[model samples]
Target chain A: MDTPIRVHGLTKVYGGGFRAVDALDLNVPRRSFMGFLGPNGAGKTTTIKIVTNMLSATSGRAYINGVSVMEDPKTALADVGAVVETPEFYPYLTPMETLHYLGELRGLSSCETTNRGRDLLDLVKLTDWREKRVGKFSKGMKQRLAIAQALLSQPSVIILDEPTSGLDPRGMVEVRDILKQLHKLDVTVLMSSHLLNEVQEICTDVSLINRGRLLRSGSVADLLDEVKARKIDVRTLRPLTPDMFDRLRAVPGVKGFAVTGDLSFSLDFEGEEDAQARLLIELQNLGLMVVSFKESGLALESLYMSLIMESR
Target chain B: MMEAASVVNNRERLPSDLQQMVTVAKYDVLKHLRSKRLLGLVILEALLLGLTFALPLLLGVDPTDDPAGYMSAFVSWVEILVIIGATMFAGDAIVSEFQSRTGYLLFPNPVKRSTIFVGKYLSTLGIIVLMLVVYYGVAAALVFAMTGGGTLLSLYSMLLACAYGAAAAALGFLISSVFKGSTGSLVLTFFTLFMILPMIAQLLPAGSIKPWFVLTFCGHVISYIMISPYPTDLVDSISLGNGEFMEYWTYYPDIGGSLAVMGGYVLICLALGMYLFRRKEMVS
Candidate 1:
């Protein structure tokens, strides 16, 4: 199958000798939600800009479904919908007007544009504010409108850069839910973001990039399985004394332990799941009244941090 | 995934380049219509037209006899309205796309940069023409009302005013493409066209070749078309105490010459502006 997005030796050097993107190579398979994980100033936005024809790559090339974006942008971008950096619209226009304009530009008929525009607006939850002028919209509303705009053409591939960047918690969840629906609808999504937890939740495949270079790329399951140790959180009915802490650290598979709260702490267990169970049993046998013992949510976070440190 | 595949296969046909250009132009016209800038220009034009009629009455100069002369004088002031309107519409049409990050949404589409540029230029031209129609429509009615006759020279002056407005818009687009900020482009276009060019035309030796090259020189045809027995090369002369005579040459550009200059500006500036816009990267 042809890859939805392919980049080879893509380098973008700005003025004053700043290499924002340096000889980067990446590929996103069809029908996959690929998380483009990176840090600030990591050239994620730059790479997206080049792919969407907003910026030109200094050397090498990028292609959408095997069409060279640099040589023929119109053809390359025909089936691609993108929301790069931030969402901005003509302040005078409403969401419906903006979508209709874009729909026409994308070659949809008037009836189809209206139908699809209304449907997309409903999907983004902007139906009530359809005719309201966008200039008065808050940033979160604009971002949602931008998402609706990106989906107007029913594009095969949707590329979003930090789609949930500036949203409040509820807004973030709302946008994430929309993206989840798109994922289910089989859109090939390549979303670049620094929010690792969001990526871990929404993405099936992952590519980690830093300083304009790709460090790792694989399935999230495979990456998670590669983690050598698991950090398991343990809660006790009462605050543990120093003697109890020493006794807890003496477990056979426990590599280290840190008290995170008065009655809770975490343990680094360098062992398999069965061994972890055995350790948990051992802790319970100590008669310390262990309330709960479960693995923490630091698996992906640790993997990302270690990879970013290794790349640096 | 199958649903998405089917949807992609069943997608509507895309537009051709010409269709896309027209779409962009139409939406841009809508944007201008919904904006206060167009209303502001209309109000300004009305005020200027009011001044044109009232100034003569206030000065006790009766133009009740020579309607052509009154029309010519009235249009001369209205020509400033055309300049202001063109500058406001076209001055930031291209630059604001970059400065305000509107290009983030616009440039990613299937349309070409040249199409966007041409679409914006055509929309700006249309608005300017609309403004001119209103201004001249009022002037023609007043002339007919006052003298019971309106000369063809008014029509001829209207054409020249349009050419001058097109040139000014072209110049504005050129300045807009060069600058990254809308305010800077707007201010510079106004100052260069209204203040600097006219000042240069005034400061240059009356008969120098430099004045002919300036856009404001071509703008004179709007007012010069009103003069009867149309003024010759040198309209007046003045003598200094040192026995040196300073001749003030009438920098009247004939119809063909004026069209050439204005058309040249339109073609060259538009081509250059489009080229720059196409090559410009959306780094911001």
Candidate 2:
């Protein structure tokens, strides 16, 4: 409750028994960039919608800066800026005019809103199109504009759902760059994304969920440590037969194995570099010519997959 | 060029409910101004006013000998203006927010849903008021240019027309809140107010039973107020040549009773519409 954002026992069962979020509890620490990672139906967007007070939960409470979102949403969301999904603005309005309307609703003065809105436009790289109608904008452009609006109030907490989902590679980098600035500003950021590497790069903490249930929540460093037990892919100069599969499985600290290619296979190993070195020696002792041996994917991605699989 | 820290210390108080409502309505009004529907209303008004002027000049049918009669000719289309204005402004007010997915940006704000609804309602009524004032202003000027004296009954008729427009807009908002698509809501609102209710009003004519409670029936006061004492029900028997007779009658609404009926529709529809809007969730 004392955190910048806290969701406790939140359950949202939509009409027709679709349980979008179930007893989902989460806390975003102050000044921490939290990555809310989940699969397609993992209730990430639902939780964001509830915390932003866009959708009502079936039961339980979500608080912003200790203010209850349900009991007093206006106060709870005063310092919270969010983009829950692919948000669309009025096509008739230019960026500046749209900002005026929203800024007025948020009790910002005209001069202040204009000045801040210009800054946000520049931050999102949209200052050139401030006077143009939003109707002509592409999806990526709108996504950037959405980010700008979320930061217009200089909110203490920022929630973004797939902020870079529709962007080109350059646009994605630009948005990520803006996000990096938020880290320096010390804004509590809760961004939901399927891009694990991006989360690994920008987030300090993460809470992964699956099927409306929390799988794991901790700092990115701790999660990486949990996944130091990595999946190492090994390649050979010759094809492996059944007897070789048996000998490969017999190695110490190798928990799982899958044949990725005719001459290559992946092993789920359980140790640091020292254990990896011993496994390489054991594989070479099996009398196969080793070609390549390396970690397969990112540490957070491995942790995300293992936790999500375990939850299922 | 923009300083986040400079504004961080300048975060003022959140807006009051009234201020929020005004903010919402202000943009909604801007939307109306920018839309093609307002242009459509303007065209409708110009056509109606042009007919009023050209008919009097071309056909030499100047009823300006009597001020009420001349003004009645101009005010005859008042019902259509109100109905069209309601259809244009209020018909899609609530549904467009949902259908077009604008609710995503608008609904999650710190502003309450009730405030948004009231703001939109005021915006609709505001347009209706402006339409009535302009249409009547043109009509009053034309009537004055023709007739030497002013028409007092036209003023009462305009007042009734404004009330009737408000009730119509309220009903339109109710339909908008209940429907999913803008086209269906707009069509249904215009059809229900202009076609269905008036057709039903025909069945319960003045002689036997009065549909005094019907919103469209009450809307008759906007025009019928010009008729002194509001002419009583006329039941006439038509003679078929072979001694077969058919009965037909005309219906007119009383001024006071019709105003009361219009007021009732406004209160009921406004309450019900606002309640539904507040309870609605932004599903998309």
RMSD (Å) per prediction: 2.1, 3.6
- Per-prediction DockQ comes to 0.61, 0.50
How many angstroms is the interface RMSD of candidate 1? 2.8
Chain B of candidate 2 achieves a TM-score of 0.92
Best of the candidates, DockQ:
1
Error of 1 at B256 (Å): 0.9
Name the runs in model 1 displaced over 4 angstroms.
B1-5, B9-12, B55-61, B235-237, B246-248
- Highest TM-score among the candidates is held by which one? 1
Of all native A–B interface contacts, model 2 reproduces a fraction of 0.52
| lDDT (tens digit, per residue) of candidate 1 on A1-312 | 458899999999998989999999999999899999999999999999999999988998998978899998888898888999886899999999999899889887779778878888888889999999899988888899999888888888899999999899999999999888876665788999999889989999999898999989989899999887789998988776787767777887888888899888888888887888888788777775789998876787788899889987
> Which ranges of candidate 2 are over 4 A from the true structure?
A231-297, B1-12, B60-63, B234-249
Kindly list the per-residue Cα lDDT of model 2 for residues A222-252, writing each as its tens digit: 8898776677888998777788777777788
Fraction of the real A/B interface contacts present in each candidate?
Answer: 0.68, 0.52
lDDT of 1 at A89: 92
For model 1 chain A, where is the 10-residue window of minimal lDDT? A239-248
lDDT of 2 at A72: 87
